[model samples]
Target: MDKLALTFELSYYLWGLLTLTIPIAIHLLSKHRGKLVPFAHIALIKVKNSPQLNQARLTQWLLLILRLLMLLVACAILAQLVWSKNADTSANLVLVSNDWLAQSSDAEKQQLFEDLNSSQNSRLFIIDGLNQSLSQRKLESKALLAFQGDTSSTTTPPLNIWANLAEISKTLPKAQKIQLYTTNRLNQFTGQKVAITNPIEWHIKSLPNTLPETKLTASLTIVSDANYQQQLLYVRGALDALATTLPLDLNIEYLDSSLVQEDLDLSQQQSHIIYLADAPLPTELVNSATSIISSEQLQGYTQADFPLTLATKLFAAQTKQWFADNARLSNQQITELPNLDLVNQQQTNTGNAQSLHLWLILILVILFMTERLLSEWPNKHSRQVEGN
Candidate 1:
């Protein structure tokens, strides 16, 4: 049996406790006020203690106490008094990499869902990367409905699981245990692995070698003057590096600015042209190329000043767009793999805390019924006394 801890899921409703005075004030103000009557024969009058009147006064106080109790219980129910367990207590924090979900097969996804459902107190979190920041969102076991479709063409970058883990560790409570479900794709494991004090049980899924074999054909025609030879070298080197990572059979050709012609196959509708010269190319060369990157677009930076990686990425992106039929490959090149065997397997079987709302609701119902019966009891007793 899970060790449950009592907590208020929505403690804001506890503010209603202040309203307990409302019933108290009403009970005090509702006292029966006797009218002052002018009595001429005060010496002949006698006063005696009546048991019925004393019993009636006691019942009124009892009714007041019950009303107060009812109000207090209602507030507790609204506050969602729950019996919950945290990660350190027993619950397991299950973190699922969205990248893994996108790449995983249907059978694998179904198996994951089954595991989550069978786990006693597992909290599911979907790990996603946006703008180089990792954000996690809680998910139910059945929330994988959208993952059943084909998402093979998603262009999102592979997550740096190790770096993300470091960030996650900072925000986690002390001594929490984590069950991480992710792919063991080397590209997904980027950056340095830091030591996390929390115990993590790695459920690493090996990815199949599905690298594309079909090489895309891309041609680049550089039109530049002799003065821009160094700029040409930078462009050429960047493209060479791009070709190795991307499955592309790239072809490069050079043209002198003065030798350009209007009828030249510069805009062959298939090639992308990179103009490196300071002089603007003829309208024919500009209009002919399928896509052109002019000197102005490069920010007029010299070869030494130009950002090679940035230029390469821009070129690679353009190539991918131009040849949409080719398979898009992940740009991350695997360096070193982490030691998965070193991970501690301290997995826990805890789930969401059991809710006490039902019990509170039942108590509220009983309070209402008892309050109604007691409220009528005094009136019923008085009628019987009059009949006597």
Candidate 2:
């Protein structure tokens, strides 16, 4: 059996339905009354009922009904009624975290695939750290192979599983079951716990102690002249400290004259360049390097804290990449879950609303034309009878 759900976009417009009483009041108040005629004798006059009288009475009732229907349809249009059929309850929606797929062994992957394939109505969705939006795909062998590659390069913050579930549940039909397949790594759960409106069967795979690591390498060049020799020492010290802690390589260069073609070539090879001179960097070098920091940036820092400040700035720039390489999985354990009743239930699909609007507009037009014709029909018939 198909279940029907009705929703209103502008619910306040439903107040217009109160106007339907106006036509009914007019119908009762404007009832046709016979006029008084002066006569010499009561027996001299014979009362004869006109055939058009019955037609007029019938038309009056029809017009009232038509007017009431027109008002109702108009109110429905303003309210923007949305009609949707609930999806099949037997169908299953499976959400798989990309982090789990990246760390899971081949045997585990095969077992998961077999379990989902056994359920013919199951649909698959992959949730990755990079993209928060859900992308639906078929549960096939080839599709599973595509997700096997290293996702660490594109990793952002830890995946917020509860938040994603809260958002995705809004679009799904009520009573439709959802199954979530993810790892039990605590680092992967970063955000605050959200209310789970939909009941989700959790398939948490325990992660191993050691996960795969991603290594990052970059070339850094520091160019300084005699004028900024003192500042250069602090910058080099900062670079040395950064090299030990971060996966970075420093290629220090000191130039007294303007950068030549060879200097530009070296700059091209380096990923980032720090220019600690008064003169502006050459347009060629600026365009060749991925990022360039000028001496003007060192204005606020005192000489005493210059090395620490410089190191902090450099680390901040590469924080995202550092997290990607080092923090692949967290060691924390999940102790308790959030309250499910707090999940937000009010969810709407834009596509369904738009399609419903188009349909209602068509019905409104047809009702309007029919009411106009019915309103004029009684008058036209009365005139024909009087002429004859």
> What's the true lDDT of residue 98 in model 2?
71
CA RMSD for every model?
11.8, 5.9
Query: Model 2: clashing residue pairs?
Result: none
Q: Each model's TM-score, in the order given?
A: 0.42, 0.67
Tens digits of per-residue lDDT for model 2 on 1-388?
3356777767899999999999999998998688978777776677888777877788788888878887888888888888865555687688887777886777777877787778877678876643444544334544775567474444434667777776776665656678888776655677677665567787786744443254344566677777888877777776676667655544555555365434667665766677777777777877763677778876543466676666555555465444443443432334245665554445453222333777777877887888789778877877997999
Candidate 1 has a TM-score of 0.42
The clash count of every prediction, one per candidate, is: 5, 0
Clashing residue pairs for model 1: 84-353, 121-350, 121-351, 267-288, 267-289
